[model samples]
Target: MTMAGTLYLIPNTLGPADAGAADPLRALIPDEVQAITAGLDCFIAENAKTTRAFLKLVALQHPLAKPLQEIQINELNVNTPEAMLPQLLQPLLEGRNAGLISEAGVPAVADPGANLVRLAHAQGIQVRPLVGPSSLLLAVMASGLNGQSFAFNGYLPVDAAQRGKQIKMLEERSRKEKQTQIFIETPYRNAALLETLANTCQPGTLICIATDLSLASESIVTRTAAVWKKQLAAGKAPDLHKRPTVFLFLGQ
Candidate 1:
């Protein structure tokens, strides 16, 4: 198959919301996933194992006629260019197009596909990105904060003191300008984040907790500092925190 000379950066909308929604964007994911398998001559993923697990879960609702490996390099079981750059770039160097797949969202936003993107640009290859779901973007959309101006601050420092200081700074920025602050934490440290926010943010600050989005347990709530404390303390813990959680705050 002749390549399109286009490198696709495809985002996987692997959430219950996208999987279950009737929205146009939601509907596009399954089609995109299928089309990439059939359309691309070669593809790259962040982690083949993670992608395989996601496909299986998606298959429960909609069986994939094509498995992921059908796209060349599937058998190689690699995702990052750091792992398969030379292999993927070989075909590209041969004038073939390649697709970049992150474990979840678009490559390089929060993943390791940056190297490939950089390399492709350096080599003068055309890069094309397809529309798909993103948990981080979704969290902010429903955060009810200053949508006009927000910063997607990635994971904060894991050390207790460092994390606390970072949270304090984020809180100050949001309060000073009413800008929304967004970030994520590892599963085990979610409650720790919640605890830090409860202690760091002001009493009346508005916090948005979007957990388990697009799954059977999908939940998103915009709450005040006081209310969130009571709910969490009363065992209304979020399952989203059990896996990956997006935390947004806009101090009032």
Candidate 2:
């Protein structure tokens, strides 16, 4: 019987591609990661185009054994059923190492690749996660909140009322349990989410806004909800619309 190959979890940069000397985001990705990626020929990714683009970037540091076109790429998305995951890992069963790459940041953290990781563990396959940038942990590190006990609440409800209710619950939990609450929103709706957060959370609640992490336009700030509201009222707050951001809430 062929021994099952290792499953590698690969990470990608957080922002838009910029191939220049000043591309700070590129520096966040480790050299070892690119080397490992160059050796792998099979991959399961969130988006094929983005994955291919990243592979090309990896090629700059280490030459790939096969042509980009010849490499096997399996697309995985939020809608992909659990049953189809086994097919993605078929290469590993054949004694060929396969990689799981996310659209950005670490794979399976807030991405849709968790199912495959779970399956790998059940099958007793070796799962290795390489070092890389993670927006969630970065936000917590900069927030000055209770990093010792924090919970990542992916995306709250989109509806105004429901979202507000969810925010209250998160704040209550943070206050009572002394846990930091982390969440995110679609880039386009970042401004709206900020507005809702300022209005819904209590005046003493601490809110951290972390945007464009590891990029040239990176910004991280923590303030009370009251202070944030005052900034918005005075037009002093930075624009967050259409930018990738992570929000953290800590109640007093």
Candidate 3:
């Protein structure tokens, strides 16, 4: 199964299937990777330790190689290669292949792997994205928001005053221009944020909260500010605050 040394970038989920399960490139696993990387030198990853932790969950006890723990995923050392020059190819140059993996979702899409991809491309190192889930796309799909015209604004300002002003402005803009503004906050603070949004935004504003997406306990609900107030006041807060969430400001 060893292929000398070739840099391979496998996405955790580019679309929606578990790549390690049914994909043709099953060697994406640590054991499989161990098999193929007998002579290889290192791996280029976001978090070498954490990535190994994930592979450990798959019960992949890589054997017959130097040791899975010793291989390096040189992402932690640098912020970004400054010049896109040949010198930065140190990780892949050590071997034929450097398996590129992001912390979550597809590499290079909304992650730091783009530089690696660009470097690989410049060197003709094959770059392929594997299949997995994406919270951003998943949110858009189930959001009832205009996916085509929407934008993922990542996280909003964390400062309470700034966050409130921005939400109100977004609510107004979404209403006036028919734009869907989607944003997220840490799960623990969901209730507080919800309170702010409910109280700050005008009544009848269409707001959607998508939480625990694709998991056992999932909730996707669209409600007006007024209606959400009533629902939450009635103790129907839902289980969103306990998990991750995506909030959408869809102007009416």
Number of the predicted model whose lDDT against the real structure is largest: 2
Candidate 1 residue-wise lDDT at 238? 58
TM-score of 3: 0.70
- From the highest TM-score down, the ranking of the candidates is 2, 1, 3
In what order do the candidates fall by lDDT, top score first? 2, 1, 3
Q: Estimate each model's TM-score.
A: 0.80, 0.96, 0.70
What lDDT score goes with residue 18 in model 3?
43
TM-score of 1: 0.80
Assess candidate 2 and give its lDDT: 0.90
Best by TM-score: 2
The residue-by-residue lDDT of candidate 3 on 1-252, one tens digit each, is: 322335565544222224354332243333344344344445566666655644443333334234556655566334656564344465456455556666655456556767766866776656655455566777878877777677667677889999988888888888877888888787788888887877777778878888876654667888888888887788877665557788887777
Mind giving the per-residue lDDT tens digits that candidate 2 earns over 1-252? 999999999998887657654433357788888889999999999999999988888887789969999999999989899889888888898899988999999999999999899998988789999988999999999989998999999999988888989999999999999999999999999888888889989999999999999888999999999999999988887788888999999999
Task: Give the alpha carbon lDDT tens digit for every residue of 1-252 in model 1.
Answer: 444266778776544334334343335365655455445556676676665654544455454555655646442233323666655766776777667777666676877777777877887778887777688788888877788888888899988898889888888888898889998887788887887787767878888888876655767889888887877788886554466678999977
With a 3 Å backbone cut-off (N, CA, C), the pairs that clash in candidate 2 are: none
Q: Which portions of model 1 show Cα errors greater than 4 Å?
A: 1-4, 15-33, 52-70, 74-87
- Point out the higher-scoring one by TM-score: 2 or 3: 2
